[model samples]
Target: MKQKQMKGVCLLIAGILFLLLFFSFSGIEKTKLLDTDGRNFEKAEVTNVISGNLSNSGSGKQTVELKLLSGDHKGKIIQATSSQSYLFGAKCKKGMKVIAIINESKGELLASVYSVNRGPMVWLMAAVFVAIVVAVGGRKGISSILSLVFTMLCIFFIFLPMIYKGISPILAAVLVVAFTTVVTMCMVDGITKKSVAAMLGTIIGVVFSGAFALIFGQVTSITGYNVSDIENLVYVGEMTDIKIGELLFAGILIASLGAVMDVGMSIASTLNELKEQNPQMMLKELFQSGMNVGRDMMGTMTNTLILAFTGGSINTLVFIFAYNYEYQQVINMYSVGIEIMQGLSSSLGVIMAVPVTSWIAAFLYSKNQK
Candidate 1:
């Protein structure tokens, strides 16, 4: 079979297996009404719409009489209210769906109306994303989406749980990165020699980024809890054996993985393509091609990493500027300062990954092509 044919078959089988695993282990359970944990109150069914009218502010408020939909007190009618807050203006209307959390002892219900139901939207968006990906990239696109799904599952199911269970954050993070790299590469590039090169490159880049984060963290005497989120994690760690500093380092490394992967894959793929195009190319010429592509990618990839951080922290930057802190002090402050360090460190990882991966691929291609 042709290489493309084999890759296509492998991708299809992998996708089917992924879907099977997803549904088989979805952890769905039917719960009894009164016996369920965190069961605050039963879902209330609206029985009578007593008053549906606009108030002085032209906002619609509805007084709904509701009864318990399930459980022991299923037949009792009680008053429930749904109103659009004035800040939302007159857009609120009657019969708009809302949730009512009831108190059995007090026979009272608190209602909050949402503009949209997230449950349906989440599933809908996921389906749409998958459809669009498959439509655009075909087999490659499917692989990319599967890799992304697996990555998310590993983070949520494996990494987050391990961290919550008090495992060392850095250790958990390393495991997550390793797992994600394998899964992502396999799906994106298939189980080929090229994919293997990409995987190796990813490992090297990831380790480099992680080490830099650790070394910089120590040299700067920056506490793990310096950042607002990590500071909260410190309190969480106090309740468990999880070390905040290690976890913080793990986060820094993991955060750099995406960009590192980008650089690694770009170099590896470019080298492979060059080899295929000119089977007689020497190691020097191949390495030159890889470096040329890397040079182009390095600037944009690093900019991508930095801009992402900047966009996320723009609000914090604005707040600091508003406070009138001196420029030196503002930049030196730990709030946005750590992000700056992190961004630059990750950028260095991307810059370094290109050459290292390219060199490895250059040597490998020269040996293998002949």
Candidate 2:
């Protein structure tokens, strides 16, 4: 018990140190960027709102008093204007928070409302999610949360920074995915046969999914520019020399990793328990048992991956349907093609992970018994 406590303390300290290092590197990068425009972005809270009519437009204008929450002019009160249009306006109310942009181009400091602030709401939702996970999962939940944090750190610190430095995005993603798989499996299952099996299966599955996405994406001529923010991404790519085209497969790999990891771990852990309970069972029997469990999980897990992708772009589909797009046009559209590739590739990962995990677990457990 004391050893476990010591290990946990060491891990906590290491996590804190890693976070400090990550933020230090991020701050340096931010400072290195050239700020040609003398504009500052800050969060602020609305103290008051006054509504006024727009001349000959049937729209209204909202004049707000904001108290800055961050940046050099923190805690300073300023007035900003917002248009009350349903299409392109931020409808801010008193007590609501907003993002304010400070412009100092013409020797005068002027502030304007940028958008509604959703950080607090997002934080609140995250807190609720953590609370539920902890309540339901207990010790395992804590490990899960730690793994999640580590994965996010890897993405923000290792993956993004590497890509920003002109590294191949696909290679960086592969490295991050491999690191995440090992860490997450170890955290959840300890350094046991199950963890080893799950990690191996997840890596294989992710690689297969990534390769499939890249090959088919090329075959179908679905360029990464199909996405909504490709122009912005292209601008960043021009600055950093990053291969924006490979981002499609990189994104598919990362998105598929979690689902593959889940399937891998579930099958391996189940088979490990089965082996423990029935030591007399033959290796073939154990493998068959694992297959049975995998078969049961295959349907819902595949649906989960497909449905998740579908849900993300349901609005696009709705728009297409509303416009009465022809069947051929709908299927041939780049956006639709991308979504299909993502969904199918991820589902393939989940499908392949089951057998890979089961085979590894069966062999490992059989060897252990021998």
Candidate 3:
């Protein structure tokens, strides 16, 4: 009725605001470093596989006939050679999609296979995820999807540009996390005591994660410079205003965000429900109840966070063992140190959120009923 109409109007206004702000972030220019000035990448289908020179690795140079599907080259038929390396290109079959890199330099045009066109499959997988989320969660799933999109846009659009402008990476991450947390919680649960508690707890937990990374990294001599890909990033830093340091801590904050927010929201929602169920409960009783619930959740949530970070390093772990590195060597490796830091710091964030969220929810619930 009237209430539903009012809620709809409010949601519409919020959506409009989010879209306007998100699109405006496109005005922030990205630093160009790649020499892509004379290159055009267009989608093309392999209409015919003309020939291949097979090597021992089953990958070698090949000539393919392509029908361009997009860009100014649409409908053009061209013959191109695949990059000889196994990592860059592969033998093609008819009807397979590949990316055609057209170079217009040297007063001539050259076409080659840059890679396979995997864009459709990637988007298809993403679509499946959205479908499953919506099918399982219904309305809450829809709200969660919107919040997820907002968080992504905040990262790639606003947070990235801010850091590129020489802003402190950690500071920019915090700002983005705070903004996303408020918007996410509000979107999920509206402006209520529980959502407020969740927002505060989420922010505190994320900051704690980043802070631990900073302090721990200092003690372990594991700065951002220790990362495996620092050389490439250093080149980017030299070319642009990007802050080369503190990206690790910023990443730690962003990585821990989902787990920390889950813990915070769970505790807040649980405590609110407990308070409503036991209206005459004392403040001490409510706090104890929250602590009890938090303790139960602490183990699994911390494990989840740790496992998530560890999962990203499974290959590194395998390599260490496969190479038969000694205990001393393995322990001292920068990759190992980074993985350990990421896991423990993120777990600590989840751990901290449990108590902080529990206390906040308890305090709010114990207030005099309005």
Please, what are the lDDT tens digits per residue for candidate 2 over residues 85-139? 6554467778988888888766677887777787889999999999999899998
TM-score of 1: 0.77
The parts of candidate 3 lying over 4 Å away from their true place are: 1-26, 55-57, 84-86
Clash count list over all predictions: 0, 0, 0
The digit string of per-residue lDDT tens for model 3 on 1-370 reads: 4645644665576567656756755576777788688899889899998898878876778999999898876898988888667578756889989998987777576789888999999999999999999999999999999999989988887888778878899998998898888888877887778988999999999989888999999999999989988999999999988888889889999999998999899889988888888888766777787788878887998888778878898999899879988999999999999989998899889888877887778778878854
* Regions of model 1 farther than 4 Å from truth: 1-92, 99-116, 229-232
What are the clashing pairs of model 2? none
The models' CA-based lDDT, in order, is 0.72, 0.83, 0.85
The candidate that achieves the highest lDDT relative to the unseen native structure: 3
Best-to-worst ranking by lDDT: 3, 2, 1
Per-model TM values vs. the true structure: 0.77, 0.88, 0.92
